[model samples]
Target chain A: MTDITNQSLSEIIDNIKTKRISSTDLTKAYIKNIESAKKLNAFVTTTFDQALDKAKQFDAKPNFDQLLPGIPLAVKDLFCTENTKTTAGSNILNNFIPTYESTVTKNLWDSGSFLLGKLNCDEFAMGSSNETSYFGNVINPVKDQLVPGGSSGGSSSALAADLTPATIGTDTGGSIRQPASFTGTVGLKPTYGLCSRWGIVAFASSLDQAGPMTKTIKDCSIMLEAMSGFDKKDSTSINKKKEQYSKNLKNNIKGLKIGIPKEYRVDNMPKEIDELWKKGKKILKDLGAQLIDISLPHTKYALPTYYIVAPAEASSNLARYDGVRYGYRSKKGKDLIEMYENTRSEGFGDEVKRRILIGTYVLSSGYYDAYYLKAQKVRNLIKKDFDDNFLKVDAILTPSTPSSAFKIGEKTNDPVSMYLNDIFTVPVNLAGLPALSLPAGLDKQGLPLGLQLIGKALDEQKILNIGYAFEKNCAFKNKIKKWW
Target chain B: MSLDKEKIKHVAKLARISVNEAKVDSLTKDLNSIFKFIEQLNELNTDKVEPLTSILNQSLRSRKDEINDGKIREKILKNSPKESEEFFVVPKVVE
Candidate 1:
């Protein structure tokens, strides 16, 4: 066994198809790996028995059409894997299990993808650093000293460590992209509503979307094709016909217009990051991508606008955890009101509490017009800005984060500074566009600086293809060879 | 930008979350700093700008209303400190 962790899902499936590796053997290998490295903390709960059962069911003449048939992949804790504990990194839902499945998780299983386990995330997907997770942070398998960029930190960590080469994660605002940036792997946040939300835990309803994170852009593209589709259960799920994300990978960047937001080159940006981005641009230019300067004039206001909009919606969405519906109730309350208050007070973490208060205050009767409504309007302007630029270029380029992964406990107490970690990636979510992060180059301490590509809605293939071309041209896979 | 002690209490109550009075001073300080930062948005002129809640600028389709029983009663109660069959046992509400 050449460390099956080194093989992609396609290679694994081919072996299983040719009977070179039994599906049972493959399933047992992943399970053994999960049991052996419990310290990685990647999986919150391993679906070992369930995965074995699924592998057996498929062992009798498996479906070859299902690209990932019998291959194990993790699901970020943010998604609802029916009957499995879907804790979104908070004690609030520590015991919460749903009877229904999220469409993406369900679809992943239906595509013959066997479960590896549920990965950890920031509490309620609130933090840019995975440290907010109540289940203890997901250690970067590549470098334990660094903090995994959050909210989907676990997904990226698992893929980078080869816990599983693939996983599904939700990005409300850079949760997926930023983590991928830190882990030096590929993560795609598809066009808004490309994947249904019926089963994923809600963070910011308007901005929440589920996408794939994997070792390579090609894996992301394949997983994305299997994931994106219409689901009536999710009203926001789009009705767009299924399109192969890998279809455009062969397309050259010849005459491709790549828009670079000069505004992202902030004063405090590290010199190494600046150098790496310039190098990434040079690689793209060498392969024929024209780097054009464009302005997202509203860039400065994105963090504030996102803060207002995300928390306001978060305040409403999280209101359901009133101890009546799901989650813990206060043990020492004298009345219903006290019960509600105490239960929530103890259930939610500090960042979650901060967001809920901000959300509620903004949406309350008197302030709704002043705060929530105004933020929504600015969101529209932000999207319009992107819509305007997409007509001029193939995709927008920006830094995935201000810097590479910050050290643990660096800014956890300062919520505002933590929120700034996603500044460059937030606007794309606000615009409901497709975005992908690829390793451009590494920094002085060997951390990666990632280049982000933002495409028009549903044209995920264009950017993924661009990423594939750049990956080959820039030799980022070689850069990443040091990590894996 | 400055949130007073009373207003902080109101915001906390409205959010249906309880914060310890001992910690309120620090939280209030933190909240004030954040609010001051967000107050920068007040500078933008937007007499004509409509607030946008969603990035998807499409109409929400009208669908016939129906009831759904989101089963999780047992799962939801698993976290309760005290519970009985069919309902969450709480302190009686009568005066």
Candidate 2:
């Protein structure tokens, strides 16, 4: 039989349904690939024993009609997985395990999906690069030493490496889309509250959202449909009915209006990124989609605003890791206060600490109104900018990142430069919008580049449809020539 | 907006995270540079916009206050650093 890992998820599903391949066989194929590609460090922990058992159970009683019956996939380590270690790629949570599974993962398991492992990510989903991971940086599968964008770096890298057909990742700023762009995988950051955040590790609660990362937009649609819904456990979980995104993804682009934001053409943008944007516009135009130039005037403030808002919320959310309950606790503390200080100081990495300090500073008594409140107000304007544009356009298009993936150590020393990696993706989170990044083409170095399709709030179908149409036209080949 | 060493130490205390004495200088420099970058947001005029706490405008959903959940004390304490019976052991506060 053909290499099961090489086929698209949809094809693999069909193969399983037709009895051409057993779920166990497919699971083993992925396990072998994951074992061989250990140098990529995509996985913080692999659940091969559990996965093989699940595959065998599924084989004993096959049910291919379910959404993802026996389909092996991975999840970013941020999600809480019961009976398994669920580190948010931080030493603070190095041995932390949730007694309860995250609602997103529970939804997948309920749909008969199989879990391959917990993929690595940035510590507490803080950094733009996965270097913040206490477990170590997840290398880009496309080329050695290059970062597979983050804080969902491991999810993107694993999918790109074919360790698993699909994976799940969280995006606070650009964790999902940026990494997807970097690794040539499709990642969708669903609308805020679209997927329950109850069991997923919190990072900037308001901006944090869980979404799917897959090799194809169709797989993204299917995964999103299975993973999203209302949950009473989470107050922010949207109460509306789950969208039938996969069913609605007809790839019909005729007469659709796609906005190209003028402010995205920033100064010093790489020439390759500009060319990719133009190529995306041309592809959409060729498919009968009308392209319109638009303006998001508050775009320049987005990154700074995100810096304040995300860290402020993260500081509050992460305050729970104070040497109580679980995770790493410093053993050399004299008392409770010292214990809390020691645990956090030793537990968190540099980037996580910096964000916490910034958060504490912003939310402090004297600076609250000036930084936190002001950032929130600016966030409103940014949301309004998107709301106004969506009135005239079905979706918006922009380059996923300013450029392709860079080396892992390239921007680690400069926090501001590292933060700029999310320049294009932050606004979407600030606006609580659903957006997707799919492979557009490769850059001069043969590294993959992606273009983002942003949709109005809760209107994920429109963006998925547009992406489906564009994917057909672009026919971007993303399979990397394995250097690992 | 330049974060001084004292300011960094104060903020770290407030955050309950320790900053090594040796690392304090570099940490101060990093914070100062990051703050300088973020201060650019002051340029945007935003005197009239309301602070948006949630983009969906969903009101805080409250349910009846009742003990409908919580019984699996064992599962909850599975990861405790030091546990005995149903209690997590921490440095004594009362003493």
Candidate 3:
């Protein structure tokens, strides 16, 4: 008998429908796996008792018509789960149990899935290595001491380790893709506004999007279908009908124009990553897709622009975490002003404070024009680069990150080096475009490397199809040996 | 263009985060390095380009102005650190 925990989401659904496995058994398998994989430090909060009860209820009344029938999922801790402790991997939010549910999680529940646990992430979704997480660094299951790329590190780690069959993560500048790249898994950042920002902890409101992290492209499609929709509460939610991505997934890529961005080939990029990108392009070409050399001229400026824009918005958004409201409040401080300062200083992690400081400096009165406004203008140019390239190409192809997973403490000291990890993934967020990162091959170190597919705004179907085609042909069969 | 200690302190104050006295120098160094990296944007001429405020091209949507939700004061104050009679208790703001 196959391990129930090792099955993909679609297979699990099929088994449930066929009465081969009940939701209780599936949930128990995952819970047992999670209990054993404690070295990864992936879960911040596990709802095993609640999960078992829900799974038992689901088994009692099997609903075969739903998208994710009787399935249990662990999501990133960033999403506010009603009556569950929702920490954004920060001391500030360590005690925040939201009274209401985030729209994305609610949607997943509506589709017949229940929460298994909350996974750890970079504090306030700020770091690339998951080191910023107040809970602790999430160990990449690929190798011990290697970081599960962050701020969606725990989501990637949990998915890779089979602690959860499938999971969801919020991507603000490669939070999903880079971790997915680090771990041998699939992560997609949907077009901005596709997933509502209603109850999720706000980072950079514009760039933050919640998407799926799964074992396969098919599972990704299934999870995305359940996780996205229009919510009236989220002002930026796209007013469009729900997409049937899982049902409509097709691998036919004949005559599709895939753009190869010249700018993504950053200097000092790892040789194996370059090889992985080349291999991805070749596989796409072999499947009858036309690869065109394209130039996104403003790509080099995207990282710097993102630094300005994201932090600026984050500084403003995070201001709501004063001592008065929900979350950690400082014991010291005589006055309201001192209280606010002390609470934030003691509550937030180092990286979060650094970003908040940078945000404040840029949005300050004297430097506003030179920093914030200039970055926004540069952002427009970055977006324009994608818009122009999309005229000649249906989707763009690039390596997800410059390198595979680094050691846990390798780049934590140097913030700039850590920021560069998102160079390839940030521009898509800037353009508010949908992109998918699929593990294409493994490096010499036996670590996984991913190739990214960027689609035009609201054209997620195209990228999903391209990724699906690439996944079927590439045949990346690397799996992590369970040492943890 | 470099962020000095004075500037870091001022920014921290503005952001309502107090920097530890011992860590100010290192924080300044990190901020300076980041600012230096961000200075690359200055090289690119973006005078003609408009600042992008929103990614979606559509104008902001407005619905009918009506009170849709309320009366969940207990729920709203459930997570508050210090609440008294539906109001959040804070340190004295008035002298």
Candidate 4:
């Protein structure tokens, strides 16, 4: 069977322009594939009718000539879709049918993209693995029993498994990056506010960002151009002028100063990932880029710092979801307090509740100074470490994750072990910096190894240029639908 | 005082959780371990370190506070499990 997805975005666009394949066929293929791979649990809800309807409606009148026009793309459940169920993979708000569209989703629809479904995610985007989702864990398309990293696991798994051409996912601390790494897909977390958070459910307000997850750097860039822009509704949204991300794909990385943070090369790194990083460094040198040693000494404190800060913000932001406002409510209670208590206790998953408790405790008056305040200082140091290093190097490089996907149940019992999943990706969030994860190479297990590139805030085009240039030189596997 | 049972209860109540008696021992142990680990943060000489709530080094930006127009109250309340007369109904308390 010819792999429909192996074709790049440019090739797909050309084919669609010539009417070689209609949008209806493309949408049907994905819907069929998603149905076949339903066992992967890649989506919390599949919008089969909606997908076909959008595909046909846009074909009659496409908005533009973009690569993704009439092309089907899945959406992570975290991004609110108007009149569509957006569960964020949690039961508390499982019935949440948003009347408004997230800026990202709105832009996608405006670009004439078709919707596939809402992919599963970590409950409230809280876990590194998708297991915490009330929808059940998304199994890795690569290795069935292992996990697809989360909370964007469903989106990555959908793309990896050939369910859709691309998808959009949110990264708060590493939701997009880590799962992309695990599933061997390209995921970008632009500067904290580069993409508006106006419609997506809040996790960690300061760190949450939305970006594209796709099969290649070029594809990721195309989708990102459609999703990113200024929004008056989202206060943190940057008002900078925008351009097509793919417009700068040809920018050469010659003489680029690439910084390798020495602190991330800790003792426990898998030899395979370390070897992949060294090989990636060599590849950049071969392309005429210079790799320099850099320091981010405060990285060791990042996980601790992120846990405190993210949860504190999450606690405050999630306060709106009380039983009186929206979402699941508890019945069979005598008093208001009992109702509220039972509702939250029964509604939230173990991981979600644990985070709430941790957040509430840290923000409490007595412990606030010791935990949250101190964490804030460490957070500044982490950002400062990046600022001082970025002054010398145009971009920073790090392993997207410690290792490839672990088995589904391996670390589910140990919450701390799971939080460690964000170590490499958290500091960038702390600094409100832009980062991209591309397939650097494959490890011994033949699973993909993801390499992350960090750029200055709102410098997404630079990272886009860097990612596209690297993909041009690197030998990337054609995205096969069966691989998922 | 070793985070006594009463303190745990208070904390759980503040968090609006219903911790069953059987789960208390395990939760206590877990919290103790986590707290002990976080105690290492106290080791840093952060006397001069300034607390930062936002990563951006820019000054705060605020718009004049005004009543903003918002709609779709029915849409917002659609997720609620129980409602009455267009308002979310909860168990009554005090009187």
**lDDT of each structure?**
0.82, 0.92, 0.93, 0.82
Ranking by TM-score: 3, 2, 4, 1
Q: Pick the candidate with the highest DockQ.
A: 3
The superposed Cα distance between candidate 2 and the true structure at residue A86, in angstroms, equals 0.6
Cα error, residue A319 of model 3, in Å, equals: 0.4
lDDT per residue for candidate 4 within A358-457, as digits (tens), equals 7888898798888998998988888888889878998988889999889989997667778778889988888899999988777777777798999987
| TM-scores for all predictions | 0.95, 0.99, 0.99, 0.96
For model 2, what is the alpha-carbon lDDT of residue A408?
79
Q: In model 1, where do residues sit more than 4 Å from their true spots?
A: A478-484, B64-85
The residue-level lDDT of candidate 1 at B58 comes to 72
Chain A TM-score values, per prediction = 0.96, 0.99, 0.99, 0.97
Give DockQ for candidates 1 onward, in order. 0.56, 0.85, 0.89, 0.62
Which of candidates 2 and 4 reaches a greater DockQ? 2
Residue-level lDDT tens digits of model 1 in A118-181: 9999999988878888898777765665787899988887777767858888999999999999
* Per-residue lDDT of A79 in model 3: 96
Cα deviation of A211, candidate 1, in Å? 0.6
lDDT of 4 at A458: 76
> What is chain B's TM-score across the candidates, in the order shown?
0.73, 0.88, 0.93, 0.82
The parts of candidate 4 lying over 4 Å away from their true place are: A64-67, A478-484, B1-5, B64-71
Model 4 CA lDDT for position A315:
77
